[model samples]
Target: MLSDFLALFFPRFCAACEGALAKGEKVICLQCDYKMAKAGGLTDNNNFVAKKFFGRVHLQYAWAYYLFNKRGRIQRLVHRMKYDQMPEIGEFVGHKLGAALLRQGLQHEFDVVIPIPLHKSKLKKRGYNQSEYFGSGISKALEVPLDAGAVVRTVNTASQTKKSRLARWKNVDSIFDVKDMAHVRDKHILLVDDVITTGSTIEACALSLQHAGAASVSVAAMAAAK
Candidate 1:
């Protein structure tokens, strides 16, 4: 077949480790998949992720797929996915997280999924919202539809890396607004994102959904800070 001939000429490599991968392997090799940490606290109320946003936002549940340590494999995976236009990596992680949550009956608790939206400028430059790609994978695994444009980012804020927690909160406040509330009103919303560092972005998005009359909000991401 033509595909087989192309594969023989240009074999794919793992996105994280950059090592040779098998014929069907994608961003992560099989070995790395087994080694990657899964989200264990997804349904727990007192998980660290929920605790991080304590007093800032009222989350029904909050969890992430992997523990992020700088220079670690998880970090490498996220970096490649975000910076290299490897959208498949985000979806892969999302599927893993979604499947794990599905096993615990977590999928049924939410009625809808929404990705943390990126600003139009950034999205235009990147050509994709990594979080939406992640959400799409989760939606596919859960048999749910993703509301892609449910939330819109209106302001372009600077990086929150070096900012203090309070400053990060200020930077993210009012950056997002909800669209089409009739579709989301009175429904449980599962907010999706690629990662949760300071929790500012998700909190802002959650507030917008809450203002739009969403019954409840839960958060999921590909990874979380350790």
Candidate 2:
């Protein structure tokens, strides 16, 4: 077939492992997908992601799709998604996670999905928000509205990659503002993000939503640093 012929000449590679993708595979190959370090027990209230914000922000639920390891396959995939113009990877992962959540009967828990917004300057440079795409996928799967405009990032803070926990909190503290509180008011918000490092950014965003009168806030991320 022409499709087969094209694949023979120009094979598609897996985003995580860079291995040739077999038929029926998209983005990540099955082997790499199976090998991914899943963050299980998502339905539990005391899961790892929830514990990260125990004393900081109140969360109705918190879950991450994977446990991030330095230089691991997930790191490679995330790097490509954020810096290599591969935003589809985020959506792909989000869709898979969303589907799994749906299977667990969690679809009705959240009223809306809101991705953490990027500052306007960074959004202009990236041409897209990876977290938004992730939220879009979840929104589609959960049959909920995806509201990227409900909140905005006021400060373009320095990277938290090298900062300590307290420093990270300070950097992102009070940096988020609710744009139209009406949209989030009385709604159970599912806050989506690409990664949860020190949990500072998410905490700040959740606080902003809570202050804006959001009925409840939950957190979901593609991965969390181990």
RMSD of each: 3.2, 3.7
* Candidate 1 structure quality by residue, lDDT tens digits, 1-226: 3224434544488766778998778668998887767556766789888898899889888989887767768888898888876777788778878898889887688888899998999999988898988998888888778998878999888566788878878878889988789868999999999988778899988988898999999999998885
Off by over 4 Å in 2: 1-11, 159-164
Give one digit per residue, the lDDT tens place, for model 2 in 173-215: 8799999999999999999999987788999999999999999
**TM-score, every prediction:** 0.90, 0.92
So what's the TM-score on candidate 1? 0.90
Judge candidate 2 at residue 78 and give its lDDT. Answer: 90
lDDT of each: 0.83, 0.89
For model 2, what is the alpha-carbon lDDT of residue 181? 90
